[model samples]
Target chain A: MNTILRYIFLNLFVRLIVNIILGVNVRNRDRLPEVGPAIIIANHNSHLDAMVLITILKQKAMKIVRPVAAMDYFLKNPLLSWFSQKIIRIIPLRRDVKFVKEDMFSDCYDSLKKNEILIFFPEGSRGEPEKISVFKSGISRISEKFPNVPIIPVFMHGLGKALPKGEAILVPFFCDVFVGNSFQWTGDRGSFMDMLGTRMAALEQEGSYL
Target chain B: MPFNIIVCLMGLFVMLSIASTVVFVLKKIKPQKDYKELSHRVKSWWIMIIIFSLAMILSKKVSILFFGFLSFLALKEYLSMIPTRRADHRVLFWAYLSILIQYYWVYSGWYGMFLIFIPLYVFLLLPLRMVLIGQTQGFLNAAGTLHWGLMTTVYSISHVSFFLVMPKIGGLVAGNGGWVLYLVFLTQFNDVAQYITGKTFGKHKIIPKVSPNKTYEGFFGGVIVTCVLAYLIAPILTPLSPIHSIIAGLIISTAGFIGDVVISALKRDLGLKDSGAMLPGHGGILDRIDSLTYTAPLFFHFVRYLYY
Candidate 1:
């Protein structure tokens, strides 16, 4: 019942915000995975990043798509925690090592085993708006475990300005979402991170006019 | 609601039906060619026409509100495309807010405030707001760009809605709806006419630096076509005589061409193609309404001077 309600609400809310309120230009959207057990890595700036990503996918495919968010932020209050977990369907990960006991990747791995598509923002937290920061190694560690799963790199522009960190009001702005080709696991951590970084940088350049 | 508007809309539907048939036939003839973009454009036109007709037929208030929404979209597109300083976000908020106030003047029929609110009041006040922000590095550029955007997108476009509140003059056959329809239809028609004629017979480039596809052949061809249509439709839709209608067409064509190339120059300066991807194959709200930006204000004042 919760899943059905969440899907229905998100379908309407996201479509209204994305299609009617904002002008979103998506390129190479076909690169998104059709089935599950895949990792979609994108640069994070605004909270709208995940919403925009969710809005762009096919409706059926969107049901299996789950965004990995930090527990400290999204699960702060009781109401927010319930809303984030039930409505947004985020896989909450502990950001603070002091509070975490078991392995953090356990829930992520379990979801992947269930054939769910996971969205990872490798930049541990939202950095300066519109600027890409160095990605943390959480994504590489997870990708190593699921070597066969494809990783799709996406770079989005203008969302940061639309509803950036610390800004609640969403200014209607034209946004661009560029989806790059999917790749599998590289040899080691450094090389895999380098490959992902290069792919994301190249995707960012694709949207740049100047 | 008026009989004249109903007749004009019927004519428009017939014209669109013919266009759809031609596009369908062309696609069947050239199976290998990519008509995806062209088809998308025609499909968008259908949607736009339906929305526009609904707004016009619903009520005067709805028509004004619809144009106000258009102004909002156009301003948002302009703000999104240009580079701005972070300190100017608050000023940008005010810029967006001005659209509501500008359109309110139209809704209330306050001609005095409608004419000078943006030019005299918002113009002076925006710089003051920027000064309060106190980030003086790119101050001049920021002020100039923001004000110019307001003038073009909000102030100029608001004149379109002002047509709704305009008092009907003597000898006018159709209602104010006809005036609005006439201006919008002619502006868009001129754009298509220039594009088609330019593609077919264009050889010498008119302005290679600004817009490469524009040519003298396209310019004169669009003018002649638009003028003839204006002469025919003016009697049915507007109060203009044949000679005045021809002059109105001349103004729209020339100003429409200028508006198109001017926007092209801005995009060239910004190193971008298309303002934004709001409409498939049509670019952005700004791109779709570029000619309207010039035609709306010019035609509004032109008609006001002659009739109202």
Candidate 2:
């Protein structure tokens, strides 16, 4: 039932609103594995990023993918928690550095074991929506734990300007999600995250959608 | 005042029948690569002609709204291909808003506001709104393209639909549908004539830098043929005399040719082969009506100045 609601809300309802508002486009979407336990790493630009991510996913990929959101942000209010639990189907991770480390490891590992495709903003949280911040160490930990899962680097453009940070109303803008090459972890956290960040940035530059 | 819609449709049906037969014989005779494309084009033409005639015959309001929606679609297709910075998005809404305003002028029969609103008034407004957005990067590029996009698609194309509201144009036909029919027929016929002649007899490139397909032989041939068609059909469809219709036909074909080439240039500059891929054989709404963008405003002004 939750999966059906998630599909309806994310795939159908949110996709509709996003298309009507942003006119989203996706390129090289077939690059992602059709049926696999994978981690989606995209540039975090707006509140619209996750929904836009869902909009860009081909139906099968959309069903398995769940955005890994901060527990503090999503699971705080009861209504938001219900929405996050039921419709968005978010894999909530604690953001607090001390308490989050152990809990984050287990929640993510369990989700990956269950074959849920997890979405991560390796930058950890939204920054100055236009700029790609240095990725945090969390993605490295997750990918290191699950060496088989492909870390798919996705780059989305124009959503920062469409919704951005702290903006309640969406301005109509053309947004595109460019799917890039995914690679497996080789135990180096620093260079891997750096390379992943470079790959995501390369996707943006390669798009030439300026 | 009432031109014969039934006769016009019958004429179109006869033309299609002849075209189908010729294509059938040609396909059987020589298995050329162009035959498949030619067959696809002819099939698309049949559908386009029927739907266009139906919309025009429906009602005046329906006809106006139909073209208005078309202009909106053309603009959407044009802008979708052109790259704009993030900051210019807010300004895009206002640019789209001009379509409604431009069409409302057609609806209300307000000529004065219709003439200058998009080109002059909205021209100033779009940039001002962009300036307020505070992004300096690509400011000029964004504003200029949006303004031109609206002007080319909405303001100019509105002239075709504007025929419905012209003071004395209703007296030229039962409804304004015939005037629209006449304009569209000549414009489209010019396109077909150019393509068919260009494919068959074209040797020298007219302006290869812009449009590789346009040939000098095709240009002169299409102009001469479209003019003859206009001269022959004008008395049956529009208010112009044979001599006047010949001149109008010459102007439309020439202007139509220029419009098609200019849009080709736009596509080339943007590194796009076609404006879009919406229509199967036709390309995009912009590709379909690039000539109408020039022909509509030019023909509207010519008729309005002398008659209305």
- Per residue, candidate 1 scores C-alpha lDDT tens digits across B99-131 of 889999999999999999999999999999999
CA error at residue B302 for candidate 2, angstroms: 2.1
Model 2, residue pairs in steric clash: none
Write down the DockQ of candidate 1.
Answer: 0.57
Model 2's CAPRI class?
incorrect
**Which tens-of-lDDT digit does each residue in A1-210 have in candidate 1?**
888878877788788888777778889999998789999999999899999998898877789989999998999999999988998899999988775456787889999999999999999788888999999887888889999999999999988888878877777777889999999999799999999999999998888782
Which number leads on TM-score? 1
Q: Which 10 successive residues of model 2 chain B have the least lDDT summed?
A: B168-177
Candidate 2 wrong stretches, greater than 4 Å: A1-41, A47-49, A56-64, A70-85, A103-108, A123-137, A147-206, B1-62, B80-86, B131-142, B167-174, B232-237, B276-284
Error of 1 at A91 (Å): 1.6
The whole-model lDDT of each prediction reads: 0.88, 0.81
Model 2, C-alpha of B231: deviation from truth (Å)? 3.7
Each candidate's interface RMSD, rounded to one decimal?
A: 1.8, 3.9
